[model samples]
Structure formats: C-alpha cells, structure tokens
Target: MATLEQCMTALEGFVGDLAARPALSGLDRTVSCRLTDLEQVVQGRLVNGTAQGMEAVPAGPSVPRADIRIITTSDDLLAVTSGELSFGSAWASGRVKLEAGLRDMLRLRALL
Candidate 1:
C-alpha cells in the first residue's frame, strides 16, 4: 500500500495537471478530501498554478470554488486513482460517501 504522504503527493500532482488543462481554465473550486484509509483530510482549491498544501488551495473567481467532502476506504483511493474504481460505482457500492448541498455536489462534479 502507498503511504499517506505518497498518496497526497499523487493527488497534488493530479490536481496540478487538472488545473493545467485548457478546458479547465478559470475553473476555481475547493475540494475537501478525506482519505478514510489513510485517515487524512486534504482541502484545496483548483487554480491556475500548483498548490503545495491546504493553504495553497485557491479560493477566488478566476477559479470559482466550492467545497467537497469525500469519504472512502483506504484501498478505495488506490482504486480511484488507478481508474479501477469509478466514483459512481463506489458511491453505489457504499465504498464512498459524499456530503454536501446539491448545487455544490453538481459543481464539484464539473470541477473535478
């Protein structure tokens, strides 16, 4: 299994790449991630530049932001990151849970 730090690094890289995508430009959003397996919470905003830590997650109009909460098992992270697991599947299987307003959830789906 990957260490929590390693998983965090991977997530950071994934977000960074997402931010760099042209289609994602000007998409600002905040996603609070809880890695149940790792027992960690990562909160950040999607922005133009890379974010290092929680504080660096952007929160501005250039990137409209919304908060997202994700709950999942440890092995689930690996599955999600590897594309072996889909968010819809995990949610349906009760492997992942999300708590938020309907609007926020929909916005998150688009941002993420």
Candidate 2:
C-alpha cells in the first residue's frame, strides 16, 4: 500500500511525462484516476498534452465521470509511474483498468 501523498507525487511525475509525449499532443480530455486502496479519485484535465489542476477527491456518485477513467490501487499506480511495472502488463493482468473512447484508446496506445 502507498500513502495518498506518495500516490499524488507519483501521479505528478507521471503527468509530467504525459505532457511531454508527442502522442498526446493536441489531445484534450478530462481524466480521473480512482485509487481503490485509498478510495479516492484524482481528477484533472489534459489539455494539449499538459495536465492541469489535478486534485484528489473522495470517490462517490457525486463525482462526475471523466472522459478517461483509470481504476487501480495506490501500489499499482506507484509501480507503473516508477517503472517497476509496465502499464500494458498492469492493464492486461487486471491490476489496472482503463475506460475511454475508441479514439482516445487508439491515441493512448502509443503511450503504452
């Protein structure tokens, strides 16, 4: 298990990388990462490959769904961001769950 702060830091680093990816260029979408272990969701917007205003919120119906949704544990999030676990492996093995539209999925494949 990882602490909320640790997860936030990991996500920040991950988003930093995401912002620099040419594959994500010109893509704009809202993203939510639901951390099952902490029962929290980190919400943010990806605008032209840059992450903006990311914040953690409680997970519940009150939270509106984002265009891109990711469900996983804090540990898995840490593992992926730290390169201890590959994103493709995590998604394939069910450690990570990604929900997005077909177009977004195709664009994201380059990131994996």
Candidate 3:
C-alpha cells in the first residue's frame, strides 16, 4: 500500500501535466482530490492551464467548492502514477471515482 505522502506526490505530478494541456487552457476552476483510503483531501485551482494553490486540507467543505472531484485510493493512485495501472481501466472497474459538473465532466474526459 502506498502512503498518503506518496499519493500526494504522484497527484501533484499528474496535475502538473494536466495543467499544461491545451484543453485546460483558460479554465478557472477549483478541484478537489479526495483520497478515500488516505482519508485526505488535496485542493487546487486551474488557471490558464496551470494548477495553483494545491495543498492537503482537512477533509470537508472547508476547501473551495470543487468544479471537479476525484475519489480514489492511495494504492490505485501510485499505480496510475507508476503506469502499473491505467486511469481509464481503474475508473471503469470502479476503483476510481470522479464527480464533476456536466461541463467539468466533458473537460475531464480529455485529461487522461
């Protein structure tokens, strides 16, 4: 099992990549990543195709209301980062869950 720290690292790297994608350009939205197994939440915002203000916060609505929410386990997170698992497969298999508004959903589909 991966630790929460490891998951956070991987998530940051993943988000960094996502930030550079053209699809995210000019988008300004809050995103929350809720790690179920880790019992933690990491929050950030997308601005001009870059993620900013990302940090772990106590799990709750105290963080910004998310336009995109990603729910998954630490192990699965590390797997995806290490390429031992695919995001699409994990999501399809119910190991990963994503919640977002309709526009955000359409936007997220181009993420991975």
Best by lDDT: 2
lDDT of 3 by residue, 6-108 (tens): 8778888887777778777788888778887777898888788777888887676566668888888888888877889988898899888888898878877
In angstroms, give how far residue 15 of model 1 lies from its true place.
3.5
Model 1 agreement with the true structure over 47-90: per-residue lDDT tens digits: 65454355222223344233555666557766776678876778
What are the clashing pairs of model 2?
Answer: none
Off by over 4 Å in 1: 14-25, 48-66, 109-112
Who is ahead in TM-score, 1 or 3?
A: 3
Per-prediction TM-score, please? 0.63, 0.95, 0.88
Off by over 4 Å in 2: none
- Per-candidate clashes come to 4, 0, 0
Ranking under TM-score, best-scoring first? 2, 3, 1
lDDT (C-alpha) at residue 10 in model 2:
88
RMSD of 2: 1.0
Instruction: Estimate every model's Cα lDDT from 0 to 1.
Output: 0.61, 0.89, 0.81
> What is residue 73's positional error in candidate 2, in angstroms?
0.3
lDDT of 2 by residue, 1-112 (tens): 9999999888877876776689888878898899998999998988886788889999999999999898999999999999999999999999999999999898788656
